[model samples]
Target: MATIFQKCKAKGDPCRRSRCGHSWTVRYREPGGRSGSQREKNFPTKREAQDYGIKAENDKREGKYLDPSAGKILVRDYAREWLSRRSIKETTRKNYKNFFENHLIPRLGSKMLCNVMSSDIEKMCQGMCEAGLSRRTVYQSNMVPLRSLFRSAVAEKRISESPVALASLPRLKTKRVDDKSLPGGEAVGAIASAMRGDLAVSVWLMAGCGLRIGEVLALRDTDIVEGAMRLRRQFVRVKRDGVWKAELSPLKAREEGEWRDVPVPSLVEHALRHHLRNHGVGADGYILHAHHGGHVLDSNYRTEFRSAVIKAGFAGESWTAHTLRHFFASSAIAGGLSLLEVSRWLGHATIQITADIYGHLTPDAGARMRSVMDGVLATTNVSRDDS
Candidate 1:
């Protein structure tokens, strides 16, 4: 950090009918170092110049000074640089690009980063929602990029403060769209029963063990060891040249590529064995195979699942393959499984993630409260004595 210097320019003589003009200039180095552009500001009086020079010097010493012109740089230039520096997955990169192009760049690309305020951001978010954008898209695509951009600007001393932290953000509901539409325990069994062959086995795995569809598709005969099945990776689809292609990747866990075992239920084991004995599997030994023994895509499962629900006497129920996963975790919690245990079985990144989804579905909250209240009243003996 360097100190600011005050330079005063004084007029030596006045014209016959005019007064002499005088001004003060405060000169300072740009925030980074001496290599930066030369900076100077002028004031009408020496006292004002000295005050600002002192403040600038102190701010520079404390690392709070930002160049007034630094923020004039367009957001597009900084955002593009920010995106280029990040190492991310292909699908994630594609999504971020869409967010930048579709949501943010259209509205804020030309604007300078420092000129934007939290109110502008709040209005942008409200406008997106008002324009019928989903809450998920608003936060993930628009708000996240905005936050990251301003955060970087502050770190680089391009701006003195972040607009994101300046105010409260608009409400964005975090619940999944299908949270209300997931099937109950009875519906789970019926759908599993309606499926046949590989679909049947896959549904049972989702319903009984809560394995994700990607993990189910990636399950191999080689993964089974000592009556436990390992989930180390998932089948992901990445786009190339505007076409999605299947690729195997690590699970989206706290530790990337995390592997965990799920204890096999007798029913799931029976269903898996039945499919294995009759149909075998793809060359990869995948338990769930697409037509012609390839990876089973979501498109393949959705068509079959739609028919299965109708066939299972659940014609009016709206259910997807993911619904089975939800039902299994909720049912497990209702049936006396601890959240910590169920979280492990479902391979959740944290117990909090498991509780966030199925926490309200747990039956013990009301039941245990009832038991505790009843016991407390019984021990008090107040009801009998008053009677």
Candidate 2:
């Protein structure tokens, strides 16, 4: 049986020549006729000494217990290790790293992983909000990394529980803007009028076929066959350490039910043919290329496209590259295509997204309930004349 004083001695050595001089001691007896005795130098309070001793004894009994030798590990250290194992795209990883380095680390880096409580996380979020970050951006740029860090700690048994659950942060409020769709007929004509060279073909593909910017840049001459384009690859620019690098990768879910061939409109096909004939395809067979004969980067088109938008007086108005995709989906739906078909064309994961984003565009959507009610009344024949 261990006494409180004996437990204190088991903790470790205490400073010698102290005022109270309450030195707790421990003795270890070996089976092989060997005995060892150790004494803590001195403690001011017997209670402090006893508490330390009890913890040490408990740790000794439980092999799983480990005393924090260098204090608790900081949140920042765990975050780095967590990110190292994440299987995300290069761009996503870079963004996560940036969020940690720029926002999370500077504020909570020194906080002990085990000691961080829900209050600390809530305060951090409030600070970010006060700093003028939008609620959505704050969640993504700060809370995301913190949540991941706490989750990792829980999984590694570094801490028994995650504080993220206690934080109970609310989702950011978002207004679904009616911003999806191509520019109006006048704006489209203006863009077409202003665009020359390779830019013209790219814009045409986006507006006419609903191709994403990445898909447009990834298009190759060989991809166009028999008035159809095979969708396979997408060109994306990922920021690595503050510099953007262009990469050509296969489209996500290109196999196992996500891939499809899209029919090219006659005008788009003609424009593609003209661009290929005049500029000639790259050695890599890409239809779009930089002036120096490499893949056309998003930045390159961004500058040119923004300039064209402004010159056409659509700048600071209802026009963006993605709007062209919206335009394609809207046009397809209005032209008597099913929602599922439109979703497939846009490479969306589900038709629900297609319906949600563009459901308001249906001319009869608002009157659907009224139409149903009218049909019910007509079938019952309880009209005013009958009454």
Best prediction by TM-score:
1
- RMSD each, Å: 5.0, 8.5
Q: Write the per-residue lDDT of candidate 2 for residues 243-341, one digit (tens) a residue.
A: 788887656545322356788899999888888889988768888887777888888787777778888887776577777788777877777677777
Error of 2 at 286 (Å): 1.1
Q: Candidate 2 lDDT (Cα, whole model)?
A: 0.72
Q: Report the lDDT tens digits of candidate 1 across residue range 111-225.
A: 8987888887777777788899987778655666677778889998888889877856755544632446777667777887888656788888888888887788888878876
Error at 100, model 2, angstroms:
0.8
Over 4 Å off, model 2: 1-73, 141-162, 179-182, 225-228, 238-244, 250-263, 313-318, 333-340, 348-359, 362-387
Question: TM-scores for all candidates?
Answer: 0.79, 0.67
For candidate 1, the C-alpha RMSD (Å) to the true structure equals 5.0
Query: Highest lDDT, which number?
Result: 1
